[model samples]
Target: MTSTDAASPLDFPPTPAVILAGGLARRIGGGDKPMREIGGQTILNRVIARLAPQCCGLILNANGNPARFAAFGLPVVADSVADFPGPLAGILAALDWAAEQRSGIQWIVSTPGDCPFLPRDLVARLHNAQGEQDAELAVAVSDERAHPVIGLWNVRLRDELRQALISEGVRKVDRWTARYRLAAVSWPTAPFDPFFNINTTDDLAEAERLVALDATAA
Candidate 1:
């Protein structure tokens, strides 16, 4: 079992990777895109496979149809606030879970469920980027762009996040990230985006091609 210990910049512990699974998926006809099939497995399964090796634990942030996603077997968590306040609310819900799970969870790496090509070294890279800095969050970046939803969120930012969800209408991820000492980890663009997300049916088709290409490449 992984020991629960306080983390330093040098010795970060096993933090949870929270999956945002509650999106409306309007472009994909309003169902769970992450649960959609790709490469003979659910997209969510691929996500868990990629991230499970990198984090101490995992949790799903879905707000609707509990039985629909019960097969994932992760602790299915819902938004604390109301009316689906977007990924920020999902992150907050995960934070609340982490706060209750143990006293030593240092950070959370948030990822959208549809992004199957996520980095293999996500946790390590984020921990490195936030090294010894006064950073409350670290998000993944590629091609000079930041994927705000795919963030390494520190537990220290809990209060601010709670206040934001309660008092202010903080829906935009980048806006909340703006209040933190943040950094980004960049992955080269060629075969993988590490943040390639399927937002539409066309996007899923592209993912199918990518998977086929990988099959041939292998």
Candidate 2:
């Protein structure tokens, strides 16, 4: 993993963030994965807590009745695409929303809602790497594996992303990102992977254990 002590410029503005929760969660019994509880708190709650401080604003990209997420008081945006394609759809929905709702914002950060321990420095590190490399986009990497969904996206690319998804039927994020000057920012996975996400019942149970371990360490 690449290491860096460099911080984002003090004048740099916080980017808007989108919590992707549009998945059907078939592996974990077909419900909202972020709504699953971990250490008495929902994963979505944990995600918001971790990201809210780092981002300028938070938006939830989900399908179904928005009322289900009304408790969070965030503007829940459903995918504009007819069928739930994937995270790419969610990212596009967020980009559109950001463009319409947030004036003058040029970028947005994205993360899977299921990840409970997203790094606090996620946005800063991504922006830092993107700026340093003079890349058009940046993604998070850990232990040499890139987490495509966890990255920073330029809002201007929304049109291209929309064309790729709707017209070309491109689904894989890496496939689309490969077309750009992308920078992969790495994070250490020593104690535990900060991007650890819940996908199955087993993974959820493991998340509980990790939460306990976190409390014990604290």
Candidate 3:
């Protein structure tokens, strides 16, 4: 994570963020994984709290019934594609929603709903990295592993993305991102990876432990 004191100048505007909550969560049983609790709070709540400040505004990309997420008061959107393809479908859904719902928001950042420990400077650093590298897109990296789903996207490419998804059947995120100029921003993993996501019961238990550690550190 970029230190607050050493934060670089960001030339881009504050990008809106979308929490991709439209996962089956088969590992933890079929239910909203973000609705699961960590440290007495819902994972979605922790995700929202962490990201709301960094974004211009926030929306949730979730399929199925939107009523379950009504308590959060965020505009929940479903996938634009017909079937559940992958995170690419969620990203495309958010980009289209941002274009229609949010005026003047040309760019957006995507984060997984189960990742409650996102870095504070996530959006700023993404934009900064994209600008520095003169790239068209950027994704977060930690401990040399790329979190492709968590990325900064240009809303203007929504139509192209739709074409890639529906017509070309492009489902893989890295395959799509590879077509564009991409920037990778690395963060330290000494403490914990900011992109740590819960995929199973064991992962959720680990997240609880991490949350306790964070509270104790604070």
Candidate 4:
């Protein structure tokens, strides 16, 4: 897998989506960050609303309190490897889950829980980049930054990823992506940046302000 190549929309589903909700949101006073409200709606609801239309199906990759997400109408998978293994573990979990769901789930799209403004065309764009390439992982790229975890990862590398998690102790997003034929799908940045994530209270407030602005503009 070369560093320059990545998968695009020339791919298909049963490609399920995995929302990486495993992180402990210590910055927002320790409750569920996805459940935090902005503009009369919970972030979780907004995320599902946006993501539901973009992929074949959705799952929350969270460990504790999977029952709280039962209303979402999708499976909630825990990290099968071990100890807060990060987004890569979530990706592996999603892949394994997809494999169990059907025979030909070649791809999976992922996004962060706190990113309210996730890409609307994420699945299509990533799938296009794949374009029949094997071992390729497609990811979103905007403003010269690669959102590695927000990606379309092929399920063929699931066992390799499991080994990395258990044996090699690899945790970084880029490290995992580097192991594949990675490609970046360029998205325009000014009007929308899909990788926007809310980590602090100030960021949430700003998102609320933006939501308000969007409402007025509409």
Weakest lDDT window of 10 consecutive positions for candidate 2: 1-10
Candidate 2 vs candidate 4: the lDDT winner is 2
Candidate 2 local lDDT, 1-218, one digit each (tens): 12323233343565989999999999999988899999999999999988887788899999999999999999999999978899999999999998998989888999999999887778888887888899999999999999999989999999999999999999999999999999998888857888899999999999998997666543
lDDT (0 to 1) per candidate: 0.81, 0.89, 0.88, 0.78
Give the winner by lDDT: 1 or 4: 1
Candidate 3: tens digits of C-alpha lDDT, residues 1-218: 44442222243585888999998999999899999999999999999988887777889998888999999999998998887899999999999988898888889999999999887778888888888898999999999999999999999999999999999999889999999999998888757777899998999999988997666543
Order of models, best lDDT first: 2, 3, 1, 4
> Model 1, which residues run further than 4 Å from truth?
1-11, 215-218
Model 2 stretches astray by more than 4 angstroms:
1-11, 216-218
For 1-218, candidate 1 gives per-residue lDDT tens digits of 02112223334567789999989999889988788998788899989987887777899999876788878788989998899889989999898889988578878889999988776667777787787565667888888998999988887788789898779988889988897788876767666665789988888888988887655532
- lDDT, residue 137, model 2: 92
- lDDT digits (tens) for residues 122-210 of candidate 4: 77767767785543888888899988888887778888888888899999989877877887877766554656788899988888877
Clash count, one per candidate: 0, 0, 0, 15
Of candidate 3, the 10-residue stretch with the lowest lDDT total is 2-11
Candidate 3 stretches with Cα past 4 Å from truth are 4-11, 216-218
